[model samples]
Target: MATYIISSFRNHNKHVTYTSLISTSVNHTQILEEFHKFQYMQTKVFVVHGSPSISSRLFSMAKDVGMMSEGYTWIVTSKTTNFLKFMDSKAIESMQGAVGFKSYFPKSSKFHGLKHFMGLKEVDYDGMWAYDAVYALAMAVERLQTKKHVTKLALLDHILRTTFRGLGGEFKFVNERTLLRPIEVKNVIGKGDKRVGFSIVNGEFVKKMGKTNSSTNNGLEHIVFPGGHTSILNHRRLQVNGKKMRILVPVFGGFKNILQMVVDPKTNLSNVSGFCGDVFNVAFNVLNHKVDIEFVPYLFEEGRTFNDLIDKVYYKEFDAAVGDITITSNRSRYVDFTLPYSDMGVGTLVRNADKSIWIFLSPLNADLWFTSAGFFLFLGFVIWVIEHRTNEEFQGSTTQQIGTTLWFAFSTLVYAHREKLESNLSRFVVTVWVFVVLVLTSSYTATLSSLLTVQQIALKGGSVQFQGISPVKAAVYNNVKLNEDVLVELRSADDYAKALRNGRVGAIIDEILYIKSVLALYSRHEFSLVATSSTTNGFGFVFQKGSTLAKDISTQIAKLREDGTLKALEDKWLERQSSIMSNDFPAVSPNILNLYGLRGLFLISGVSMAFALLVSMVYLAREKCQGRSKMEMLRRVSKICPTPSTCTR
Candidate 1:
């Protein structure tokens, strides 16, 4: 902008009487002291850059230079308007009646915009410029994407040719330079600049002021100057200096990266880093001003809250507080808040229950398992005892006899035993044993079904409860219907893990996002998410009630959101949030097969084998005592165990 103005001056009509370069503050002072040298020159209007010192010097000698009078006019560039906020009273005094340029931005309607989302009322010039630049670049890329061997040069060429009606106006390049929109001329009035004129690329000011010579001086009427004087000064100017800014931010937990207090260990001076701080830096940069910001952590010296933080701004205790402070109606009543940069509402988090190693064994109760084994042996022994004396097929050595007895008993469970029962007693026992086996199998299936379905779990009986928070509300939000009776008050966050691990709680539920962060941080540990709840309002920066910075910062945040920077920021941290939620465990019947479940049946089988062995020994001993031949022994056995029909007769 300065080069453009200087070039125009150099190419002016060649009969120039003189040229002046008041470059430095010292030089400006010299020119003001020696104003008489150029006082009578034909060129009365001085087209200069925005220099506070130069403007200060001009104001200091307004009478000598006839600066406030109608004959002399200063046409300055945009740099002067940027320092309007930081300009001292004296600097502003020097700026009286001075017409300065600022990039002009036309406004338009938007939807779900900064104002609606973050609470920003409007977008600034830089925001519009950024919007146009992004839009143009996006169009260029879209056009180039279809081509082969797309290169940066081609992209740049396409961008220069791109035309879009952006927020700032028509975005186009001319003379190999991006075309600048009309620049606004803020007339230096009493302590403020009012939009009195505007200059387009044609370098002609469109006058809006009602005073005279609006045609010559950028084709505008007249402008008001400092000291409430119109085109005239009282020959009085005050000297002033600018000061550094002090910014207040809160030091609290819960919202980590959004805002955090980081004090230098060596200097012990407070500093800050986070999304809030980063966005603030960007906002100021866009404002085209360098502010020496001294970040002061709001030292509450006691437990503080969003309300307390807002109150500090209201009371003028600090310039502004920056953090993930929520902007709510209650908070708004006390202090002003910028537009919200994030979504509204809160959610829940729950610790994933650790899996049990022996969970596979839970299907059947221990008694049922043991009893099934007992029945196995009982059925085995019954058949062996009933058939041993009557049939040769049951006749075997002690070990073989025992093996047969156990095999037949267990085999009956699957209806796979090959040997037929010779005696009616054995057949009756077999039939009953088969029925028992069917009952046991059916019972196991039903028990497993109930366990896996969990259709009737007691919420309160096993749920991890939160202390200092309404368990009923938490449960309701997390989709667990429970009253106080079902809620277990926790001592701390750790208690949730402990109670869940120890089987003291059925489910653990809490703030969902926080739990996700914790789970991500502790990804090595086993955890699970039960559910996330209804939306809770979002967090935002706090400010003194009605603070413009709140609006300004919120506006920048909104821009960031519009450009998808907010989504990127979320993705930045969210990507680090890994999940350890595992569903690899196979679902086995709670009545899973185990040694303990079958121990009772095996024990009964051992005892039955022993009883059979004793009977065999008794029979052998009796035969020996009888001192009879094989035929005699056979005759005695036949009499005791005849055919079923014979026995019935």
Candidate 2:
């Protein structure tokens, strides 16, 4: 029967568990006390199966222990309820408000006659079954009397085949020997019981005969369960010792916008409000069960950490801990945590540096700048060699030629040069160089624009600071590599800003959520988040170790995240403080252009210049060979490439 109940629940996608409390020698009080050790909030429905004496005592003990309350349910099997008539009135009274199942037999003239013969006003199901067994044996004997054989085997065969409508509903064999009938679902009332429904052959409930008013969806009539409640009890109304659940929240000096506790002067009641509070409220609203909660604030002291706050839950001082509590491995050993609703990571908040006078050169590093300058000089020499003999623009003294060459090379950056090309070799070199210049100029412009618009800072080999109250500060120290002497502890956002402004600390290291709160509190433009490390889990609600409420609330938190409620809460509580900040200054630094990023463009330009120089040299060699006299060719070349001394004469 227990297996059937479990399977039926599983078929409907509902979880069910069966616990056996049957002890051979233990007293009823010991068994009941042992059962009380299980969490009532976790397990609601309990099915009791035993003889009438033991079950009656257990039912009375359950009522005394407050288990027969609004959030609990007690059920009994036919083993106890089938013989309820033999028990006294006190035993029946103790079973009040309990639901039980018993073998059902329809009322007929034969049933009444059997009850009258037994001299009893009411006959229980066991009495009816005995009457049906006697009637079936009589029918089998009559059938065998017609046959010549009176053997034991022949009598058993006749009994198996016999069918009749006796005191019981149907006195017939199904599947060769077993009789099947419906079971009545009864609610224990004043002195008797009420027929609420019937469990048919398939273990499904059907309304009692001639009853159309059903209170529950399971086709059962109105049931007065334990605690005299007419409606069904779900698991959500769990209480701690029959009172509201007490939750501990941290009331500290820093990051109050994330979590804060305020006391009303008149009422002396504490109210919690902030991003963490809003998240908890939203998650609680969507929970499957209803749980009353009370918020108790733990005043922060110098040496007390969040670990101490979580320890309160472990020691049973509070049912749970909720606030901006980080989930860490050390704390997880003592308590369970819900899924993190905030963003994870440690952020580095540093003061924005003043813009430098030479900010134009900030886009490219030294390697890229030096490489570009060298390529400019090389391309100028190559073009001059190719055009020196043929083009009049190239005919000049050494100083004049040097000035013109450098002018032509650098002018390609703006595409503004007066010199005209006479050789295709020189034009081809210029064309390729111009393309390379175009790519370099465009990259420089984009990178420089980002630097000018966004605040830039550096934080290498400088002192760091963090909130001393944060439990994850040690993790931040290990990730960012801070020394004992160089670490500064601050308590508030204003202190963080003051320390950075006066150069007391180079960077402030903390969780991303706390860093964001600091940015929102002050002028976000003055401070920027430059670096981040994913070293710790974000903030979550805390519960006692092995508490099922933690898992239930975690499921609700996930749903809130998926539906965007969590984001809306963040914007309302956290993002609104920094409404003046724009999307231009993100939480990370912009990428800087380097020599490695433009290596291919420089490679293409170098190859083109080399090819042009080779072609020009080969053409000049052929022309010199075609000249009639070597002296005449020499005179021509000397006139084109005059020395600085000759140009002065």
Every model's TM-score: 0.37, 0.67
lDDT of 1 by residue, 524-624 (tens): 34444534444444556665443435666677778888898766665454444434332232122233455565555445454545555566567668877
**Candidate 2 lDDT tens digits, 1-649:** 6677667556875544335656556786677656665443345567777888888777777667766667577788898878776778887887788899988888888778867887897776776778778888888898777777599988888888888888777677777766767788989899988888988765568887434435565888889977688877544325736567889988875777888887779987776778898888777777645556689988877688888898898776788898988899888878889999888767778888887899998889899999999988998899899888888797789999999999988888899978999888878888898898888899889888888876665656677887787865688667756577778789887898899999888888888788778887877668877666788888999987656578878998899899998878878767743463433444456677888988998899989988988888888888887775787887887897688677567
- How much lDDT does candidate 1 score? 0.58
Evaluated at residue 498, the lDDT of candidate 1 is 68
Position 139, candidate 2: lDDT? 84
| Model 1: lowest-lDDT 10 consecutive positions | 233-242
The numbered model that scores best in TM-score is 2
Candidate 1 residues lying further than 4 Å off, grouped into runs, are 1-244, 252-259, 265-268, 274-288, 299-303, 354-513, 528-530, 533-535, 578-649
Clashing pairs in 2: 236-289
Q: In model 2, what is the error at residue 12, expressed in angstroms?
A: 8.9
